[model samples]
Target chain A: MADPFLLAATALVALALGLGLARFLRGPRALDRVVAFDGLTIVSVAAIALAGLVTGRAIYLDVALVYALLSFLGVIVAARYLEGGEQ
Target chain B: MSGVLDILGGLLMVGGAAFLALGGLGLWRMPDTYTRIQAGTKATTLGTLLTLAGIGMIEPGWALKLALIVLFLMFTNPLSSQVMARAAHRAGVPLTPQSRGDALADDEGRAAE
Candidate 1:
């Protein structure tokens, strides 16, 4: 049987993703958008892990791990560009 | 015993999702870039960790790999947030008007001498 609690949780996370997207589009400064982008990634990771739980699949967990790693790198690169840390 | 575990895992998942949503709210409502980063990093790290732990409880065989993901997240999330905050500050992103102080500015002034 599908767990109702997990289903609700996933729905809530999807709502959070929408909110993050709003901030990303409307943020006044570039860094504000970057922060919103980072928040969206973290929420997406949570959603992926929960999907693994709901579907009885371990492979999704691996996908979550790799996605998290890539998101971290993306944020760092964006931050470096904002800071003008490299030419 | 199995039923008990299922219930516990479900609870953790719900709680994690709640925190994740709270972080999103903070991101949308916070006054400045630094505050938004603070909210996003702290809430989402705990939220993801709880979700991973819930999954581990549900599927015991996947626990080892799930633990590794949790560990990596704990290390990277805050580090990335810190980098973003520092970069924003250096890039001259303005703080909220009510902000009381700028310690980084003081540090830069000291360094200039």
Candidate 2:
């Protein structure tokens, strides 16, 4: 890419994604996996946003917005499922 | 002026990405679920916000949409974290062995008093 800063940013976000994935795989508890998943999705959203910036395309940001909303909903629903009737 | 903006935006994006990496490190290294949640939620939220802001500076015309994403994230990120934490607490996900008391559990005890 022409932008070294953004290129580095992409690498860092990719590193984050890898770490989150490792945690998701190594989790001893369901909650840990959920937390890892939450972090992973957020990183993915950031990645999408970075892609938008790098490509100079506003449309990617729209995709990012929808992704963020859906991930939030997914996390909430998963948490609620795990909470069961204890709430 | 545009050059300066580009430089500043690049710096912000780099900083934000660094924060995102730190959050992932925390997720990998933290001993327990709650601490991991704290690390994952707070750091990534800030990182995402800073990143989006940098993108906005680089492309001013996209500011409104970027702001919408930022606002939505600010509202939902912590809320989802809170929900997850509460769920984990109720589901009996134990804390780290060396950790202090849980205020949420204490609140429950006090409520019964």
Candidate 3:
């Protein structure tokens, strides 16, 4: 059976994701949006990991890892571009 | 014993999720860009790490991989946020009125000579 706590945790993470999206949409500046985007990605990682735990699947952990790496790279690249580091 | 472990894992997951929610709220409520980044990065990093560790506790065999994920996040999250903050500063995002000073700005001024 899936753990009840894991289910609750997933719901919490989803709520956090919604809040991040709200900030992203309400941004007063580009960087504010980027910060919100970063928060969204981190919460998504937590959500995915919690899902893997609830489902009893090891493979989903791999997916979470890859997603984390890709998100980190994307944030860094976007930051660099914002800093005028070239296209 | 298994039940005990399950309870522990559940507690950790709940705590982690609470922190994640706190980070999101900070992002919504903070006064300025740098403050929001600070709130988001610090809280989410701890939240994600706790969540991964909780998952590892639930599945002993997956502990190693989960630990690796946590380590990667510990390293990357702060670095990425720092980069973002610097970029925001350079892009001329203004600080809130309560901000004390810009040490980086002073450094840049000294370097320009």
lDDT minimum window of 10 residues, candidate 3 chain A: A78-87
Two-way lDDT contest, 1 vs 3, winner: 3
Query: What is candidate 3's local distance difference test score?
Result: 0.85
lDDT of 1 by residue, B7-112 (tens): 7877887788889889998998899988999886678888888877777777878889989998988898888999999898777776788899878878678421
Residue lDDT tens for model 3, B1-113? 58777778788888899899999999998999999999986798899888877777778798899899889888998899999998987877777889898888787774211
- What shift in Å separates residue B51 of candidate 3 from its native position after superposition? 1.0
Q: For candidate 3, what is the DockQ-based docking class?
A: medium
Which lDDT tens digits does candidate 2 get at residues A1-87? 328998888999999999999999998777788899999988888899888877778899889999989988999998999886332
Best by DockQ: 2
Q: Looking at model 3 chain B, report the run of 10 residues with the lowest lDDT sum.
A: B104-113
User: Which of 2 and 3 is the better model by lDDT?
Assistant: 2
| Most accurate candidate by lDDT | 2
Candidate 2 — which residues are off by over 4 angstroms? Answer: A85-87, B106-113
Give the CA lDDT, 0 to 100, for residue A9 in model 2: 89
Predicted structure 1: lDDT = 0.84
